[model samples]
Target: MSLLSMTKTNLKALFHGPYTSQFPLKAREPFANTRGHIDCDLSTCIFCTLCDKKCPTGAISVTRSVKATDTTPEKKGTWSIEPLKCIQCGYCVETCNKNSLIMKGECSEPATENVR
Candidate 1:
């Protein structure tokens, strides 16, 4: 081996840069239109309940006549998501008519259970 090359390799190994995150302790900034989870905007939602029908995991529920504000017409609905149950199949994202649901594309680690 060349004398100069051996010195370069050893120097590079000593200066390892910052790599991974300190996640699960600190929250990261949300990326542009990041799909953390699909939530419903009750004000604009038309009570179509289309998302409820399309969700494969039954994560979303749509309820009409929920009174959030008197000024708004009570065109209410709900979106509930259980991350553990989600298959990440992208069905709900495709079916949303009002762009209420979207895919952020940042994949989350699958949660694991501890057996006693």
Candidate 2:
């Protein structure tokens, strides 16, 4: 009786197709309010270092230029984030006064080395 039941179940599953989707070919949608990676908009950013200070894990780093001259009008500063160290807490995004920091819904890609 047990063997018959097992066979019936196996046959049903065989014709039913796979329960899971092909992950690589088709990715799942992100959940509602998913805390993903942080992104910075350099154009609007003032490099105020507020995001760096608010980061709990010290994932954000801001390097501001010493001085802005007329000749070097575009010399603002460098803003970078260590994706490996980020905890996706969203504090950095909230602390950004210029609204330069953005929390993207898509997750960060896999990386063997630390990405800036």
Candidate 3:
């Protein structure tokens, strides 16, 4: 390609604007049905392990921790998820026996100090 054509293409594309929203200044919203992050309500979970089993990435770890009680020591649900490993699949949320898990459409931008 010629130098002129290459320069024009690059300059035009930059001036055309980005496909994403303005950072920090704008509060961007995800699509109405966009699935982003997977979070679960710890209180509603029954330690069924259904969600853990259904997770394809094995990102969800359901640990049974002892609840604080004077009378007896009972197992309570402790759900943990690794954000880096999650594939954003809704299978865990769908297979949950309790309607505890929720898919939050959180932004995927990394924390950067670059002002430009």
Candidate 4:
């Protein structure tokens, strides 16, 4: 577009206000099928390592460690998902048999930590 046309367009947009809502004041809801963020319930989770295996980006981490004091046959692990690398593909959710992993409507906000 020409400079004059661009200027006119910008002026119109400024006077009429933005077409979208101002962020932080009004946020749009996620779509019904949108895969936003992943959450895990540790108590319900069996630490099967299925989510870690299913994650395409390798964002999910499942670490299993045996405690000497605990005499459980099954080893337990902590689950963590790195938001920066996650693609929100919902692969982990589909793989989780225990229903401990869930995809929430709200995604992770912008962050400076571990940002590549």
Identify the candidate with maximal lDDT. 2
Better of 2 and 4 by lDDT: 2
Best by TM-score: 2
Cα lDDT tens digits for candidate 1, 1-116: 56586887677767865455668776577777555555555556676678778878786676665565634534344455666666657787787787766666465555555434
lDDT tens readout by residue for model 3, 2-85: 657688778988999986878777977788678888878866777778888889989888866555442221346467787777
Q: Which ranges of candidate 1 are over 4 A from the true structure?
A: 1-11, 22-34, 65-79, 87-89, 102-116
Q: lDDT per residue, candidate 2, 28-102, as tens digits?
A: 888878888889988888888999888999999998887655223257788888988999999988878989889
> What TM-score do all the candidates reach, one by one?
0.53, 0.75, 0.65, 0.70
Which candidate, 1 or 2, would have the higher TM-score against the true structure? Answer: 2
- Ranking according to lDDT, highest score first: 2, 4, 3, 1
**lDDT (C-alpha, whole model) for all candidates:** 0.64, 0.85, 0.76, 0.83
lDDT of 4 by residue, 1-116 (tens): 55586887788888996798887899888888778888998878877798998889999999776665643424466788888889988889899999999888887787678667
Report the CA-based lDDT of candidate 1 relative to the real structure: 0.64
Predictions ranked by TM-score, top down? 2, 4, 3, 1
Question: What is the Cα-based lDDT of residue 111 in candidate 2?
Answer: 61
Residue pairs in candidate 3 whose N, alpha carbon or C atoms collide under 3 angstroms: none
